[model samples]
Target chain A: MQRMADYISVDDGLVDCEVYSAAVYERELESVFGRSWLFLGHEGQLVRRGDYVTTWMGETPVIVLRSMDDVVRAYLNTCATRQVTLLPYDAGHAEVIVCPAHRLGHDTTGSPVSGQAVEPGHECLVPVARVETYGKLIFGCLSDDSPTLRESLGDATWYLDNYLLRENIGGLQLVPGVQRYTMPGNWKLLAENFAGDDYHVAITHASVLAVRAQGIEPRLNNSPGKGVGANLSVATGFQTGVPHGFLEVRIGEEFFEHDLMRAQSIGPEAAEWVRTRRDAVDQNLPDLAVKPYSFHVANLFPTLSIIGNGTSMEAVGLLVWHPRGPHQTSVTQLCLVDAGAPPALQRQMVWALTHQQSAAGVFAPDDHENFERLAENTRTFEARRVPFNYEMGLSGEGVDVRPPEWQDPRWPGLVLPRFTEMIQRDFYRYWRSLMDR
Target chain B: MVDMELTAAATAFLNEEAALLDDHLLDGWLGLLCNDVRYVMPSTAIMPAEAADARERRNALRWGSFGDDDRDMHFWLYDEDYSSLNMRVRRLDTGMAHAELPESMTNHVVSNVIAGQDPLDSELIRVRSKFMVHVVRHENNENTFVGSRWDKLRRTDDGLRLAWRYIELAHPVLPRTISIFF
Candidate 1:
């Protein structure tokens, strides 16, 4: 079996194809997913007592629920007795979970509640080691020794607050149902893409951008530094020591310029909402507000990815790339909007997410195709012999450094130019470190 | 009672529409829709069958569902109006919608058609049918989508034009990208 060093060389910025092999994948399920904090679902999904949503922590199915005490908790979804699934539904309100096999019942706390006396530990659902919430988003970890969720998130929270906990506007609320679909690829590929792969945007989504460009007026295009090409010149990617990373495109004055164009196309209300939200941000997170950057794509460690497009206030999507096997990933996508936003604005937000991020959307399908092809190509022995390149912005690699004036003293973590693979390299370095233990 | 003539007409219209999509003649397919066409496919979820009555009762008061598609407040796979639908077609025409660049060969099978004249409107018919869309892309990448569809067809000088459509895909988790229409 290949060692972690053989699979990934952070210094050389080369990744062996064997990183996606079954052996490596199995180890990742343990070292990476098992010990790390994994996103379950948002608190908005659990509005009332007994409300629960079923999701996966790695491959283990877990139920995240609001208990009778109004505290949020999670437990393995499998029945203690027969090992059958406790709840088969995606989400529902249940006072007591009854195992379909043999009429055993479990209370909201996952303790067996059937009339028959049960063994204390043998008949209770296994609880996850720790459950924590950052803003409204909930995460669970299987290892008791793992760092707290806040520590795992590290400096990434500074950027996430701009979107997750917007000022005065109550936190984000997910649209009713999740858009779940399967894509052919290793889960890491999708996570890395969101981490800091803005380079692919100009090429991978050329067709969608073309269609959008035709719809926008030429006047809107006058905003200096409007598109990806211009934004890349000022884009910044951050690598938190915890391995979490995000890419931010600071399109200075063009921050809310799209709203002006949208106002003409979609009534004045569009521009009004942007103004109100901008005021809230300015009043609350003055530091983040001052930074003239709105577009953000971040992968919080393993599978959770958050994307916020401040230009289109309604375009926020929370994605989970759940690993299915060595070659397949199941994605659960949720559209999030400010809970305090008007119904019309919320609807528009959902529309934006459905139009661009969902499986059938104009943008995601193209990315899915590329991921599927990558999975296929890397499956063969001959293909596995070749190494994938990740040296685009390696230090001293002749890549232009961001101008000194562009750097923000307030931003934490190792910030690099937008067109760099530093985040991906650091992400793999952290993964390799964890596996080495 | 089922209107046999209306059922035949609706079946023929649906079959022809499917044929146009299968042939990748998206523009021809677009021509069969009314000016204010609403083509929608709502995401589905799995729930306990025993909770059906409680869920339905709750759905009556609130216009959304956590375990099923709620037209008003839930997420949808596709919630396109005429303009959006037209834009999607235009996107494919660009020859760069990579998901369909080497477009898939599709076979749309429409069955179990049931149609009846709308009681309130003389020139409108409500129709329901089951559909199985089999698609094969690249070499061996195959995906089959099975679902039921509800449509409101309006009588026009040209023939029956689809005014509204609601699709309920059976799978709770879709197997692949829905690059092709249902």
Candidate 2:
């Protein structure tokens, strides 16, 4: 069988189609997902004792809950006796999870409640190796040796903190009800897209950009220019050795100015709130603040992806691309708003997110279509011989190292010009490193 | 006994709306909506019976606690007002909406129609119906969406028009992109 080295060449910027093969996919489940810190859900979801949300760590279903002790915990959502799934629901308040197969009950902390005769540790719900939280976001890792959540996040936190720990605005609170859907593609496809594929945005989302340019839906409009080249030039990509990647478009004070001008329409209080928040950001991270009101898409390696706009009106959507197989991916998207914002502003942010990024949203379909086609194309024998090119910025045309003037001491990553595949290349390099282990 | 005439009229209106959608005559479909139209599709969840009941109780207590009556904290596939709906139709008209560039051939089946006079408004009729939409795009790319809709139809000057529609898709996890309106 071809090894990880055969499937990807980071230096060559070429990825073999066989990377999507079943063998590679199965290996990644253990090598990459098993060892990586995967995002589970936000702490905001499990506010009260007994509150629980069911999600997948890779393909393994786990239940994240606030136990009776008020400590957040996660356990394999399966009965130890027959390995039957204990909880079938997406989320709920459950004091004890009972297996439908045999009526065996387990407490929220994965302790057996009904099984008395079974051997100790044999009949209890299996617990994940580690469950940790970065701010309000909860993450789980299957391997005990995996780095701490903060360590795994690395310099990526510099960007994440901009939203996850924004100033003046309260911490992020996940909106209820995750938007779950299945996509026809390998999980990596979606991950890489969010990692840094700003180039595709102008072309893939041309229609939406065109419509937004006309200013028909002013609240949802983020496009600054009509031409594809003009739109592509505004954003830049950032990558870290931690394998995290993100794209950002710097909108500068234009966003605050727009918010102030349209204050009467969005309501004066909400407008004033925006002004205060922007000022807080400027005070906190003066260098990074200029880029606050921009579109951002980032992937915290392996699965979790975030698409957020820094504007008060736009929401940050956290997406998990759970691998279903070599070809299928199950996506769970949760919308988040600043907890400090007024209820009305939060609602508008949610609405704006729903309008642009949800299942039926204007932008997601085109990306899904492309991913589906890529999945199909890469499955054939002929396609396996042809390597997918990732060499766009390799020759240094239209790509530049982070200029000294643009550097912020706080932001620590290999920041590159927008229209390059360097971020995707770094993503594969890290994936290859994991697969090599 | 069911009001057969009202049911027939409601069914006809739904069928007409379905026809316009299936035909990709989005503009014509938009014409069927009242100026204050509210089209919504809430994301569904699978929960234990007891857990669902508990959530309902919690929601009941928390309903008006937020000051604003915005109980729509849950994510939705769509929560469109008339203006947003108009913009959606206008998006498709742009011919660059690649998801539907090679527009999907759709068949919208509307059934289980039940209509009654609204308790609060004599000029409005509350209607409940089931819908199965089969969509085939790019030959092999196909998906079927089956759901139920609770709609409020008002007797407007332009005839009975959809004022509010709440869609509940049966699938907790949607199969694929929902490019077409239900």
Candidate 3:
């Protein structure tokens, strides 16, 4: 490797096409994303028995809907001839999914309803592979050999359940749709950024956090965003900090003051939601050492990440890693929410979840400006070391999360100074692993 | 008063408006509107068939005809005053509104104008046109924008001053940002 002093080069590209020629993105499309149990959607998406929504698994388009039998299903959304775009809209419910091109159609359960144009032989939106549902969570694949969704998640399901899934939990609902934002950088840059990088708050998101109000009438200096203002309680010290992938920050008590009981929808039942969310955050979250648990962001590799505490619906972001060229990547995120709720509650969740997390979100955008500038401007003519240092929490305190997400279970969260460089390091580490696969 | 001449004037008025938009002259674009003019884009929902029928009767399609295109909350040269428009212009100048950036360049190709008389005055005119817009930014490639536009023109010696403008964008998901004037 070159010295850290040298700047980044196109040669420092994300994919080493030569070394990993066999494990190309094409292979990833056919293998990784196709069979990795990509999240298709949640149960709330279809409030009615026969409603449906559609999404993608890598490049494979899939439809998800609640069948007339009340079962949620996932199926290859492509036409039998593979000549259709499926449903283009991000999310919508249809009694039956119809294709305009081949006149192919299917019921919510992936069964042929009509439009095949073929005889009674082969028909419908060809059931490409496995379709699985974990409560409201739905996933699909295009490969018959793909493992079940539970197998793909591996031991990580424990983390998912402990952190998410709760009773009266609103069933981990995805808000009606999502707030979309695109990040221009290396696709890995964003994936790793969300995977774990709490050290960035001191600089990248300093202003946004400095101005964040505790769900109250945040007193901006008579201005929307001035560093210091009347309403902001500035004197308190933040948390110490944690290692890579683990983050914690303090949130004030003056939060979760929603008058949902007066909302008339859940009304008295709203207390169950409050308890479920608060309990989940308090029990499951680990310390980030420096950043406190009051605020936290945890990402479970490759694509999915959540930004949340207990009460607030953490933005569940799905990354669309689109390679722009040899190095440029456009990472698009669709923040999820509970779709079963009424529109009034759903809207608030979308912005708050993403407003705190998306690439353009107050915090994420600041980080974006930094990474984009880093990636776009670093394509120099000469070789230079663009070493991203994660030495801060190394040994002195809050180093790296041991083993990192279920890959190894016994690792501890501490590193020597300039300690954990998990994301960038593991990215290359996994890159090599996939190449050999 | 509402003749082909009025149609000619409305075209020029729209042309100037487009020029201002291209030039990042937001206040100038808002200046050519009537205060009571409405500017709204209603939400699109695929409700049940029963509600869908009622919505059609209410013209609840993307832009509620009366609420968004005809409501009194719309701004113009007189009502918003220069300050309100200036504030809007400032909003564009600042890095606040992520929806659209003043830096984005645009082209509005307006044609197929349909003109009629204003009910309040025979001397006034209401004109509608179908437009195809093309926008380009440094980072993104050119994107086509399809929308229909309506304008109420009150003749001034300078030609015709705009009284109202209602733009109905055909593609609601919008390529990027729809910040410029149409």
Task: Write down the lDDT of every candidate, Cα atoms only.
Answer: 0.77, 0.78, 0.47
Candidate 1 Cα misplacement greater than 4 A, ranges: A216-240, A264-269, A285-290, A396-408, B50-71
Interface RMSD of each: 2.1, 1.0, 9.9
Ranking by TM-score: 2, 1, 3
Q: What does candidate 3's lDDT look like per residue over A1-437, in tens digits?
A: 22211222112323222222222445555434654556666666678887766655655566677778887776666666765767766566677778888667777666677753566647756664666766556666566774566655544454455434543345454433333334445555665565545556555644444344221212111112222211110000011111123233233333333322323343433444444455555544453322111324444444555555333333354444444432444443454543334444343344354344543234554554565445544445231233344343223222332223323322122221111334334434443443344
True contacts kept of each: 0.68, 0.80, 0.00
Off by over 4 Å in 3: A1-23, A81-124, A143-186, A197-299, A305-421, B1-14, B27-58, B61-102, B108-133, B139-141, B148-182
Please give the lDDT score at residue A389 for candidate 3.
43
lDDT of 1 by residue, B1-182 (tens): 48999999999999999999999999999999999887778788886674778767643322212222333676778877888888788878888888887888999999999999876678779888999999887888888999988788999999999987888899898989788897
Give the Cα error of residue A422 in candidate 2, in Å.
Answer: 0.6
Cα DockQ of the candidate 3 complex: 0.12
- For A241-308, candidate 2 gives per-residue lDDT tens digits of 46776676444556566656654476878887777767766666775622445446778887888876
DockQ of each: 0.59, 0.75, 0.12
**B91: Cα error in model 2, Å:** 0.7
Worst 10 residues of 3 chain B by lDDT: B70-79
How much DockQ does model 1 earn?
Answer: 0.59
Q: Report the lDDT tens digits of candidate 3 across residue range B1-182.
A: 34686677677777887788767767667767655444432212233445667657544332224432222221111112233334434544545443343255677787888777776676568787888878775574456877776566776665566655555556423333233445
As for DockQ, the candidate ahead, 2 or 3, is 2
Q: How much is A45 displaced in model 3, in angstroms? A: 2.9
Residue A388: error of model 1 in Å? 1.2
